[model samples]
Target chain A: MASTRSGTARRQYGVAALFTAPFFLLFGVFTLAPIGYGGWLSLHREQTDGLGLGGEPQQVFVGLDNFAQALTNTRFLGGFLTVGVYCAVYIPVMVAVAMVLALLLDSAYARAKRFFQLALYLPNIVPGLIAAMIWLYLYTPGLSPVVDLLDSVGVPFSLGSDAGAVGAVANLAIWEHTGYNVIIFFAALQAIPREVIEAATVDGAGGVRVAWSVKAPMIRGAVVIAVLFTVIGAMQLFTEPFILMDAATTINDSWTPSMYIYTLTRSYNLGGAAAASLILTVVLAAASFVVTRFSRKGATP
Target chain B: MSDVSTLTRPAAEAAPPAVTAPERRDRRGVPPLLSKGIVNGILLAATLWTVLPLTWLVISATKNYADLYQTGGFELARIRLWDNLVHLFTFGDGLYLEWLRNSLLYAGVGAAVSALISVMAGYAFDKFRFPGKERWFGLVLVGVLVPSAVTTVPLYLMASDLGMTNSFWGVFLPGLASPFGVYLGRVFSAAYVPDELLEATRVDGAGELRSFAQVAFPLLRPAFATLFLFGFTGGWNSFFLPLLMLSDHHLYPVSLGIFTWKESLAADSEIFYPLVMTGALVAIVPLVIAFFSLQRYWKAGLTAGAVK
Candidate 1:
């Protein structure tokens, strides 16, 4: 009997291991190992011995010097500022647009809600690189009807300028993200107890007022989730600016922090790139933690 | 019921009910017709914002090279969609077809395997009472928190060290380990697969793996479908990792291929412009169709990922 029990226990472990091996194996090798090696690489730099042109370089320990260098480098610092301006422009406009659309759909008077939802979400199906390329043509001076319309209307629009580059990238980002977030916000809005909304309506609250004071506050969790994910997505801003760099002259290679890290790898500065990657990760994780904490606090009360 | 209530009520009181309608309309401080117009007009504009670029892409694909720059986006003149498609397909000996095939192989195979692996791991975590189970799950949660873009460079460096760069394995293998999918898988497992059914199978003397295959997996089909659709879209949309991993133009995904063509537009706009416009349209069609068709799964997937 004891032998049979042991056999059953061993079989259980075997089956469990068999089921989970692929995920653990891939995650360990690809995700965990890279992170560990990245930490190791972040602390080391290549150095030449005496008159070294032909010999292979040695890996010398640099400690936190790479992080310090990344922090102080103007181009790298400028990348953060560029992303800062982008988030500043992007997050509010995107959340507002998505929230407004979600509210409109939730409104009693809105017709064909599913059609509006599906149409709004159509762009989210387009890949980011493709979306950026589509907008690139639209940002181009002569080929774009939008550009032509703005020109004919006596509005100066130049994709070559820095503001134009930022706006162009923001437009593409908003176009892709707004609808998906509208879905998120709409789901949250739907989860609200209808009685609460009815009660608010009975208290002389109008449609816009209920959307503001009642619905938005009730779905604060979804709003925070949306904001957190948007912030994370903003941190990984690469595709749009990278594609836009071809059309927008003011956009540099190191336009965003991720772009900066990519440029570092392209230049074979693995240590600096790893350090920048870690820095960005730590910052993003910390930001996520704070937002989660804030959301938790808001939830409790 | 309305007719019965009206018959039960006095005629004078019933007649006064119509006056309440205008008062109820005044409660919102705006007439219903005007507000409906305002709400749906804004929605229409927002939909247009989301959709006009796609419309432009569809329209621009039909224009020839000269007409692309000369004509407006919606202008219909000398439609050469077939000519442009021929150029796109036959360009550089059908490079676009190779890209389309590569994208399918990467996204299709990567998403299916990734979803299966995630479900398996999630099932094990839920079913087995292993020591350090929560610790193992925490590691996956950590993976979820750390964004993939942060890990792309280091993965690239390691892949290069393994002499795997510029190959399909370089891009394909890294995408398979989606920690977020695993997290979702766990949530789905708990929601979908009931333990009693597995216990009943155990009582029937079936082996654990066999029981899971026959009983649990079928029950978890919706979860698998959800994960697959999300993974498929994610794999199709991935840009940064593939961009860094593949240098061979033949191995480039459709997105990267379109990007390269557009990047060279300054040097040779005449040949590449219409090809890119047409290529963009072709690349987006399959994913759009898939999204609209299986939207039920994706909508559930989106809210599931966010709500938790």
Candidate 2:
């Protein structure tokens, strides 16, 4: 009986392993290995002897020198600062826009909520690269009716300038992401117990009042997660600026942290890139931790 | 068995409940606080904001080079949309078609395979108990937080080391391991696949794998659809990894292809502009169709993730 039960237990474990093995295998090879490799790469730099053309460059252990350099590099620092400004403008606008749309959809006064949801989410279906391309044309003078309209209104608009460029990119990000967050917020709103909402309604809470006082607080966790994702996403801004490089002169090869990493990698400064990546990851992780902790505290209270 | 029948009886009865709540609410005759006109106006404005760019894209695609440059951006000129489409497909030895094909293969196959892996793993995590299961899952949860961008450089390096850069597998392989998908899969499996059903199948002499395949998978079809849509869109929208892995234009997906065209527009604006605009429109059509047709699944996926 003991032997038979052990056989069954072993078979169960084997079946579980069989089912799970593929994910773990791919996860290790692609995810875990790169993380470990990146950490290792961050600590080393390529050493060259003579003209460095006669032989392969030697990778020497540098002991955080790359990290130190990445920290001080103005371009890298500037990229972080650029994204910082972007986050400042973007996070609040996106959150507010998404929340308002979600609240409106959840409201009794609204009609065709499904249509509005689909319409708003259309841009998100367009890849970030494609959206950026579309917006680039819109921001361009010759190709864009937007430019023509602005010109006719006697308002000069140019994505060529730094502020204009930032705003343009931010607008693209907002347009692409707001719908997604709206869906999230809308879902969270839908999950709120109907009795609670009815109670608020019975108490003569206005549509806006109920949305603010009841729905918002009820969906605070989703809101926090949305903000967290938006913040992380802002830090990893690549596709928009990468595509907009042709349209916006203000955006260079290293206009954001991910861009900086890409530039470094392309230039064969893999060590520096790795260090920068680790630093960026650490900062983001810290930010996420703080946000999670803060949100949890707020939730418990 | 008695408990199962008892639990299902109430659900079976409740499933056919009438739409009386809305009717009763209407009878209550409480006036809405917010004006319908104001709500509609706000919604209309938001919709316009969302739709206008795409409408511009459609219009721009229809315009020829001269019309594109000469006319007001929104004006529809002589329909050269066909001409643009022909040019886009025929351009540079039909590179756009190749890109489209590559994208379809990558996103379609990648999403399907990834979803399968995710579902299987998620099912295991849900239905099975083993040593280190929680620890393994915790690692996956941590993997969720590790931004894919942060891993790109390292992945590139690792791929290059293995001489996998510029190869399809480099991009295809990494796209398969979606930690979020696994997380979602687990959530879905737990929600959709009841333990008792699995036990019943097991008692009927079905093996664990057999029970999962025949009994649980059918029930998890909705979840699978949701996961597939999520993975498909993710793969379709992926740009950076492909950009990093692929240098050859032949391997370029539509996103990269359109980007390259946009880059060339600086040197030769007149020729590349219409082609790029047209290509962007064509490239987005598939995704737009998928989203519109499979919107419910997409919404379900998002809500599932959000709730978690």
Candidate 3:
């Protein structure tokens, strides 16, 4: 009996391993190994001999020098500030826009909800790079009707300026994401128990009042998750700034963290780039931890 | 099972059932605190804001180089959209076509295989008990947090060391292991596939692999489709990794190709500018079509990730 049971257990183990082996192999070799390799790369520096002109640069061990340099690098920290300002502008504006649209769609006064939903969710289909490209054209002076319209309205708009760069990038992100989040917020609103809204209605709560007081609060979990995910996603801000750099003269190679890393790679500073990548990963991992924890709490209720 | 049904439900029939109650109340006599005109007006304005850039892209695609420069974005001139597309296709001995083909190959093949790998792992996690299962899953969850951009430099380093840089394999290989997809797959397997079905298949003398292929995988189709669409968009949207790995123009995805074209615009604005505009439109058309046709899957995918 013991031998038979052991045979069954062994068979189950073999089957399970067969099922899971492909994922583990790919994840380990591609994802896990790179992470470990990046850490190792982060601890070394490439050094050249004899005026640095002839031989291949030998990678020499460097003890925390890259991290120290990254810590003190203004361009690196400036990238963080750029992203911070972006998040400051982006998160509230996007959430508010999405929330308002969702509430309006959920309201009794709205018509053609499906049409509106599809219309709004359209931009999410465009790739981020393409979205940035589209916006780049729109930000162009003579080519853009938007620019023409602003010019005609007596508003000076130059995407090349720092403030303009921030606004342009933020607007591009807003245009791309607002409608998608609207769908999310709208779905969360739909999932709210009908009785609660009715109860609020019975208490003489007006439409706006009930939307703000009851509906928004009830879907607060979704709102929180959306915000947190947006924050995490914001850290990967590369395509927009990378594309915008061509048009916006003020935007440079190291204008964002991902851009900073890319610039490092472009200059053949792999160790420094790897260190920056590790720092970014650690920050993102912490944010992700918060997301997972909050998500679990959100799921429970 | 119910989650799958709701996810797969036709959009027309999926309207909020609770909408009628409020509509009835409004008709009975409660004055809306926000005016009807105001609410709809806000929505209309929001819709316009969302639709305008796409509309601009379409209109801009139609203008010639001269008209593109001379005319405003909304100005409709002699329609050169077809001409521009021809130019885009025929440019530099058909470079754009190569980019498009590369994109389709990467996104299409990469997403399909990635989804399958995820589903297999997810099925194992959900249906089987094993030593160190939770620990392995925790590692995957950690992967879900490691942003792909951060890993790109390291991946590029490792790939170059392996002599795989500037090749399709470098970009293609990394995209296949999405930990989030694995996580979603586990959730889907638990929700959609019952262990009793697997047990019955076992009793019927089917092998483990055979049961998974014939019995469980069929039920996991919705999850698979959702995962595929998610992977598809991700692969399609991926730009940085390819930008790092690929140097040969022939291997460039449409996104990177377009960026190269845009970069050249500073030198030859008259030629590359119109091409970039038309190229952006062409590149997005497939994705737009896919999104519309597979709207349900994307919606389901978004909610799954968001809720998780």
Candidate 4:
């Protein structure tokens, strides 16, 4: 028994070893190490006296202060609130629009699906900076064709105020991401067994009946996946707001935990930065786990 | 092919073919006009929404601030493109070009090498046997869930400890290790590689590397293309690490460079708005080209890295 076990072990070891290397080494150095080290760094704060300069800042262990501070910080609070509101508005619109597009691509009248798929999905591939630039140009005074069209029609419009910033940013995200989700949903829609649809048609069901009764159930997992990724991403929402900083002026520095960390790091508060990062790490991990648990459940059933 | 249309096309597409065919015969057989009209209208609107802002990027990249402010965006006018290119390539000691180069290098080399490493590792993991295999596989899965953003500060500290901070390597070296690649390699090997082939090669006395190179590697081209494209995109799009690691403008990647440009503009100065716009547009070209040409690989790539 032992010998057989040893032989099987050796075989598995040799085969698996080769397959895991490139990823393992990279994952270890670039990924796992940083996470472990970040945890360690978060346990201590650099003690600084008046001016926080002219004297050496000593790293001293002060358990939980940094985490507590980060948690209670008003800006962090506001940032979280802002992003939560943003996600509330962003996720449903993006996902619903994507599903609708995916359904359209799946429909009969649409020609050149490859063209539409590529076109719809193209915005996703555009770098965030470029996407921001394009949107920012449209949002800026006199540079906006929409504003011009609005002026030509004499309709009052503005994308500058607090009420408008989230919507404007959300609009960019919708443009960038809807196509991506649409493809996923479209693929799911594609993966639906044709026999099922044919059966529905034979049963005298119209397209709406087929979609609501049969198609929707089958694509639920994909919808969940789209939602999961969007949610995970929505939780981290940084680049959009970061680039739109000009418009988000009333947005304040700690518009999100990420921004908060950026601010702390910029202020040269390494300890605080480390602590805030650690807190974010924990929150994100917890959130990701919950998403994964539900998504896996969704994927399987 | 027939199934393709029925499965993937949007719902209002539901009406078009039926409508046209029924029209040829009679109006009695057509589905409701509202469903078709609503679906097409909404879909076209959505597609337009997706396309418009990005369209502005190309047009904005070509125009000067004068045209931009005057018209507020996009002219078919063939002006300022050369001037924008020249300025973007030469501005402030030509740092924008350096960032672009850094991004290309990071994406090109980092992804290529990482793909090779993942293929080898994945192939081995699937085909060969070693100790602690399950443990290692589990570790990789955990690593997959771990976002790189969480590791930025720790990584920066580690780099500073190694005296690698502010160097191009500081930005690029870490990119070479991708947990996702290894897992993907594993998935590809499992799905595509036949154990019998490996056994046959062994029977013929091909060594491990020889079997992988001559037999297994050929089977992995699709997977490699997928891995390379994904790895390249991720590397190119990465920003936080560069922000944390490099202070000197010369060492920046396009993502970090744009952020810095944003910050500079925020410093209440006249700012390099046009140059930044031009630079942002230039930064997207490589990704756009990569996606258009490599889209086939992209679908396969997503399955391995993101989906399954």
Candidate 5:
């Protein structure tokens, strides 16, 4: 009897593992394994001698030296500052436009809400790389009719300038993501109880007033979530910058944290790359935590 | 599940479902309705702003290389969209077609396998009681928050160690493990699968897998749609991982192909601009159709994520 019971237990375990094995196996090797390995890599640096081709890179354990370098590097930090400014301008503009567009769609006069919703959300479905390429074409001098039109009108504009590049990059992101946020916000708005809105209207509340006090409060969770996703995404901006890097000469190797990591890794300095990513990961994670916790606590009941 | 949460709302989170009391109606009141025509006009204007770029893109695609520049931008004068496509497909011995083919393989198979794995794992996690589940799941949640792009180099290093870099499997394998998909599956299981039904199935001689396939999977259609859309979009849009893993131009996806085009275009600015425009227009077609079809799933998915 004991042997039979043990065999049944073993069989159950085997079956369970078999069912979940694919995800667990892949997750372990590709995701979990790298995270652990990245931390280890962060603690060591390579010492290459002479021409660096004839000799192998010697691995020397360097504690906190990478962190030291990252902290002290003003040029590296400029990447952070550049994106920070980008987000400071980008998020508000995008989210505000998204919310307003959603609200307009949510309004009764939007006869074809479904059509408009599809139109707004469609841009987001296009791959960022493709969208960037298309926009790059538009931003091109002779090929860009928008530029040609502006030039024809005597308002010549080049978006590749350092002054305009941040805005240009932000515009690409906005075009790709505003539709996504609009979809989320519109869902939030639609989720608002119609009867409640009707009641607010019956109570003499104007459209703007109802939006500010009633509809807005109800959709606070959606707003917070939209902002959080945007923040995390903006901080880790990659595709547009990668696609547009050549368009702007002023942008450096480390135009963002992820870009910095890419630079370090591509140069075969995996240790420093690992350290930079770790720092970026920790900072972004902390930001997510603070955003969620603070918003949850401060959310209107 | 979709309508229950939205069609009827509990008075409060702590309150049990009671008869509709209709308490505390907003007593303040609304302003008179604006002219309905004016409201529709404003909405129409917004719609134009929303879709004009895409419209211009389509129109510009039809324009030939000569007409593209000769006749100003965003016009109907240069109707060579078909010509532009020919150039795009013929460029560098037909690389664009390869990119399109690669994209389909990555997005289609990766998304299907992903949906299957995510649904099963999510169902198991939700319905089964096991040790170490919560810890493993928490780790997965962390994985979701950290952008996969952030791990590209590490993934590269690890893949290189195994000689998988520069291979198609390198791109396909990592996509199968998605934390967000698992979470969505869990949510779907919670929303769809009921304990009483599971108990009945178990009592009626259905084994666990049998019960799940016959009983739970059908009810998880919304979850499947959500996962499929997410995975498809992800697999389709994925650039950084593929960019890192694969180097051969033959193996390149459209994103990388476009990148190469951009680099060449930078070197020599010429009529390839029309090709790029037409290609961009063509590339976006399937995605736009995907939106129209999958748009409903997004609203439901977002509302679900928001509520919990």
Candidate 6:
């Protein structure tokens, strides 16, 4: 009986391993191994012989030189700063809009909640590239009725200018993301016990007061997660600006850190690109850690 | 606060019955009218804000190029949507169809295979007690936090090394490794799949694989559908990876294909603009249908991800 039991235990382990093998295999190859390779690549540089293109390029260890160069690169630094401005505008607006929309949907006074929820989430269903494309036409002068209407009304609404271009991209991000976060916030709102809300309403709290004091506090965890994800997303802004690059002159080859990395990779500056990627990764990791830790503290008591 | 509660107690009890008639008129099934107008008005504005661009896309796609530029923003000058669709499908040897096909293949096949892998891993993690399980699961949690965008550059480098760049496999293979899907699978499996059933199958002399295939797999249908939709949308919507990996236009997904057309509009706006708008419309149809039909699953998935 002991031997039979041991055999059964071993067989279970074998079966478990078989079931899990594909995930770990793909994860190691596509996720883990590339990350390790990127780290190694960051520490090395490609050196060429005389005339800089004559012979086989030699891979030479560069220690921290590539990282230093990446940090000082004006375009990379500018992209980082650009995203900083973007986050400042985007995070607060998105969180606030999502929270407001979710609250309104969750409220008793709001009619046609299902229709509103689906309508609001419609943009999110559109692919990011397609969303960018749709907005690209919307922001264009001759093609956009918006531009024509604004021109007729004499509002001078043009995304051709530098600040206007940034605002246009921010608007695209806001439109694409608000619905997704709204759904999350709405879900979180639903999770709040009905009795707590009833108790608040019975205590004579008005709509605004109940939403602000009761509903908002209760879904703080979802709010924090939304804010953190938005921050991380803002740091990775690429496709919107990339698709809009031709529409606006303000958007250059390197409009964000990811764009800068893309430009570097396109130019075959692998070491510098890898170094920059690592730096961005570190920043992202640190920000996520801080947000999670901060939210955890807030959640406890 | 106590004084306020006491003062409002009588009013609160009296308000519900008083508000019932108006509540019956209200579709939201709530007993409040003071804020109804304000709330509905705001919601209408928000809905318009969300929908106007899409509505514009549909309307604009129906207009001829001349009418699109000449007419007012909201006016339907002429109905040319069918003509635009024809031109879109037949343009450049039907490259748009090819792109649509590529997207469907990439998203469809990638999602199916990925869902299977995730479900299997999740089931294993949930049903079996194994050494180092917690440690392995922790790695997956870390994977969830490590944004896939940061890894794309390295993935590109690795793909180039393998000479898989510009191939369908390049995009398809990396998409299969979704840590979030695995996490979801585990969560769903734990909630849905009963271990007692597996044990009963085992006692019935069923092999492990057979028990899983016969007993557990059927039970995981909802999870499979949820994961499939998640992965499908993810793969369909993916842009940066395919952009980085694929240089060939023929291999481009709809997102990248439409983007290329949009880029061409910069040089010559008139020719490609309508084509792109129409193509954009076509690309989003499947997703919109999926959104409307599978809303409950999406809601369940979102709340599941959030609460965890």
Model 3 misses residue B146 by how many Å? 0.5
Q: What interface RMSD does candidate 1 have? A: 9.1
Candidate 4 deviant stretches above 4 angstroms: A1-19, A48-55, A147-160, A292-301, B1-41, B92-94, B262-271, B303-308
Highest lDDT among the candidates is held by which one?
A: 3
Query: DockQ for each candidate?
Result: 0.45, 0.47, 0.50, 0.42, 0.44, 0.44
> Which parts of model 6 are misplaced by more than 4 Å?
A1-5, A50-54, A142-156, B1-32
Q: Which one wins by lDDT: 2 or 4? A: 2
Per-model lDDT? 0.83, 0.84, 0.84, 0.73, 0.75, 0.83
Q: Give the alpha carbon lDDT tens digit for every residue of A1-301 in model 2.
A: 2336667677878998999899999999898899899999999998786775787788899999999999999999999999988888888998999999899888888899889988888888888888887788788887777787889999888878888878888999999988898888887788666666676665566777878887777677677778888888889999898888876888999999999999999999999999999999998998888877897686555
Candidate number with greatest DockQ: 3
The DockQ assigned to candidate 5 is 0.44
Output the number of the TM-score-best candidate.
2
Interface RMSD for all numbered candidates:
9.1, 6.3, 5.6, 6.7, 4.7, 6.9
What local lDDT score does residue A169 receive in model 5, on the 0 to 100 scale?
84
How much is the TM-score of the A chain of model 5? 0.88
TM of each candidate vs. truth:
0.91, 0.93, 0.91, 0.87, 0.88, 0.91
- How many residue pairs in model 6 have overlapping backbones? 0
Error of 6 at A192 (Å): 1.4
Q: Model 1, range A185-241, lDDT digits (tens) per residue?
A: 897788676656665676677888988877777666677778888999897899888
Candidate 5: list runs displaced more than 4 Å.
A1-16, A48-54, A141-157, B1-42, B267-271
Q: Alpha carbon lDDT of residue B234, candidate 5?
A: 81
Q: What is the C-alpha lDDT profile of model 5 across B268-307, one tens digit per residue? A: 5565667677777777776666656876776777556545
Over 4 Å off, model 3: A1-8, A51-54, A152-154, A286-301, B1-34
Could you give candidate 5's per-residue lDDT for residues A198-299 as a string of tens digits?
766666677767676666666666777778888888888877877777767766678888788788888898888888888877778887888778876774
Question: Any residue pairs clashing in model 2, and if so which?
Answer: none
**Residues A1-301, model 6: lDDT tens digits:** 1337777788879999999999999999999998898898899998886785568887799999999999999999999888888887888888899899899988877889889988998898788888887888788887777777888998776667767877888889999989988888887788676656665666567678889887777677677767777888889899899888877888999889999999998999998888999899888888888877887686554
Q: How accurate is candidate 5 locally (lDDT)?
A: 0.75
Ordered list by DockQ, greatest first: 3, 2, 1, 6, 5, 4
Judged by lDDT against the true structure, how good is candidate 2? 0.84
